[model samples]
Target: MTTHTDFRAFRIHNDAAGYRGGIETMNTAALSAGEVLVKVAYSSVNYKDALAGTGKGKILRQYPLNGGVDASGVVVASTDPKFKEGDPVLCTGSGLSETRDGGYGEYIRLPSTWTIPLPTGLSLRESMILGTAGFTAALALLRMQDNRQTPALGPIAVTGASGGVGMLAIDIFSRAGYAVHAISGKADHFDVLRNLGAVECIDRHQLVFSGKPMDSARFGGALDNVGGAMLAGLLPLIEPYGNVAICGNAGGIAFESTVMPFIIRGASLLGIASAGTARDLRDQVWQHLASDWKPAHLDRIATREVTLEQLPEVFGRMLAGDSFGRTVVRVGKV
Candidate 1:
């Protein structure tokens, strides 16, 4: 039996004046009521979590909430027969950082239905390394494949290529036999992108959309993390029957574009919202991520790991666009 009564958490509070967040020592009993109590081993920081923690965007629906969107750990207590003590598991999205207390803490209480057993090929650390970002990339690939994307079709492009999802997508797309074209604003990261399996690294500025409604085809498909003008420019360049998955709005949310790319070339614009994915599809995607879809450069993709106390600074860096790759938080031990 353990005698731990208090643990550290990164919590955010909103007030009449403004919002503030920091690491706080919290009582274990104060965790919100749920069917399962998890001793979080690791949690990865997402762009959404950065917004919630730093108040850059309206991510938290409530005040004084724990602020992490992804966690993996062992179950410490459970009221559901689907889980038991000592089971390794993880939960992503399912209203974390928006509707309830999330996984920025040493302990988390979550509905068992949101929990997933750690798949056979992934360890607790490995799962959090992939977290929501890698999962989103894999989900996008699955959707693209479902729409008939194949390795022989042509090169696949990944925008925001230095970030977590982009890095993982590059590796997975290359490993799956697709030629990956990585596009990013960070010139310094071009070599890093190539090391992660991108066959071509193009600067984001290299893409100058011709004013024409539809330009010549370039890529077979794309995983687009930066939205707005970049996305608008990309649409005109996709080959016929190509699909582009839109997952992030780090750039401006709105863009000006003609419908010629969609109507004339049969290109698809896929919207990927990872937070509300159905449980069955989530299970399927995670299983694939653990098995064949797992990237060969997971360790390379996980660039940094910080403790609970260091999360606030990390969030600041993320919001400033100064951070890259994936940063996992060490919340507790296995």
Candidate 2:
């Protein structure tokens, strides 16, 4: 139904100095060549987006790239048999915002193989609200469950509990009848974590290691978004045969950890990589998020909605570790 060729986007450019993102008018055809073109309705900000936008991390290996890892919208055209004109689709990761154009734009052309029909029971906005962060959170839980993690075991600890992935993990574990202990550096957001179903909250500083090889068992399992000392400290305290899903590295990437936990406690470390997930697993996770694993307080979890022009400010807030919950960008109306 839309005929516009040039649309607005938040594009990042790399030059002799560094990377920078700003609003610009871009041609639909200028997007990377692909089988399907989508009119983006919504996208969400993640830690990676902030890294790409501000050059805080080495995420974008290419220059002049559109930088949003998650997007959901109605399909405009498709040359592939799997998708047709006017079909609603969602795409996240799969090299988006990295090797190809991404979702910070009003329009994005992506390979048909990378697109999935928006799962039933979730709107375009809702899908983006969950975004890559929420998807990773759900995937972590799913992996833990597959490894025999159960609600009856003991409390599940979620690190970086105020961040996007951490908050959703708290909600999912709580809804699944597990007691969740949220660990956060932002002590002020303790009440928010509690409202999101975290039964107890702990400060990040309290999770530092004390050079001990092992500690008293505390958590049955853990969804850890913070790496480094937090992760190292948590390993020795997990119950036997427990799983720890390692996702983010908001804390420093390096940490010294001993093998005592794995050898003695039988704790397994599960790595969650949303970027290279298999299509079958990605589809299954999305379905689960739309059905049984969907967070009940999505509106509350989404604390802010900003236009493309307001993204720089949001990125600043995120990098300062001041933003909480999800921030969705309104690209267009579905």
Candidate 3:
């Protein structure tokens, strides 16, 4: 493999002015310390990446870092026993864009422990099509299943349904035989949501956001991405003993609600921190993403592809809530 000092990356830096990210030429030697050097073929944009790139949230623990949380590529070099040159692998939520440089570049040097060898059924591009967003969706669904959630319970509600996690959640749950009710503010994408397996697509305002703390349980379970009022509203409507996996807080972080949803209705609120998941569970989740939990419409979910130079506008669009589904970045030749 050719070792080039010249490569491009979308790097973020915080200075006296504030946080900013843009595409720039970089060298392989400038990558953060790790056990494997991957020639990143693809990376996907997630809400966290939007936050980090646009400085809308506290996603980056430090500044002057690359800013993508999901990447899939071929390893070019490795000092770890688990990986070798030419291995197709992927990494997500291993502190990328948080404590270390991430996958926004054509190359990423990652700890081998953070890498998962590409499962038999997925291609390098297919892996990034799923990316961290899809992985989080799968992880949330798996957690719900572990807590005894089943298709027989009732329809599953996915809030923020047009975004990456929500779209993939809708697809995976529907394929798993559950009726999926997608709730989104983007009315224009209702047909797209249905194409991805949403049995019903409800407008964000259609649901009652203000009412009694406890209501008749409407959904068997739910995957909540917009975590402020939307989540507060959904908690009281989950079936008894049903699970609601709390993933993203795209709406707002703080919310107020009574304990009746938990204590009276026997509802369960499960926190999903995809980045901090244990290695074993992470491995299990990725295995499922490569297999059964993989979305049937992976190509459809990856609705857009861009070069690294286009990331700033993409992140801006995400913060404005104008983007939908997944946007994969072609970082390098596969």
TM-score of each: 0.96, 0.96, 0.96
- List candidate 1 stretches off by more than 4 Å: 1-4, 16-18
Q: On residues 54-80, what C-alpha lDDT tens digit does candidate 1 reach at each position?
A: 888898888788899999999888889
Weakest ten-residue segment in model 1 by summed lDDT? 1-10
Top of the candidates by lDDT: 2
RMSD (Cα, Å) for all candidates, in order, is 1.6, 1.6, 1.6
Report how far residue 15 has shifted in candidate 2, in Å.
2.7
- Candidate 2 deviant stretches above 4 angstroms: 1-4, 16-18, 207-210
- Taking all chains together, the TM-score of candidate 3 against the true structure is 0.96
**Residue 114, candidate 2: alpha-carbon lDDT:** 80
In TM-score terms, candidate 1 sits at 0.96
Report the lDDT tens digits of candidate 2 across residue range 141-242.
889999999987799999989999988888888887899999988899999999999999998866565668898888999998888888888888899989
Clashing pairs in 1: none
- Per-residue lDDT tens digits of candidate 3, residues 1-334? 6554668899999999777899888898888889999999999988789889988888888878999998999999888978989999999988998998898998999987788899888998888888888888998988999999999889999998998999999988987889999999889999999999999999997666656788888999999998998888898889888899999887799988899988987889999989978889888888887777778998998989998989988988988878888999998996
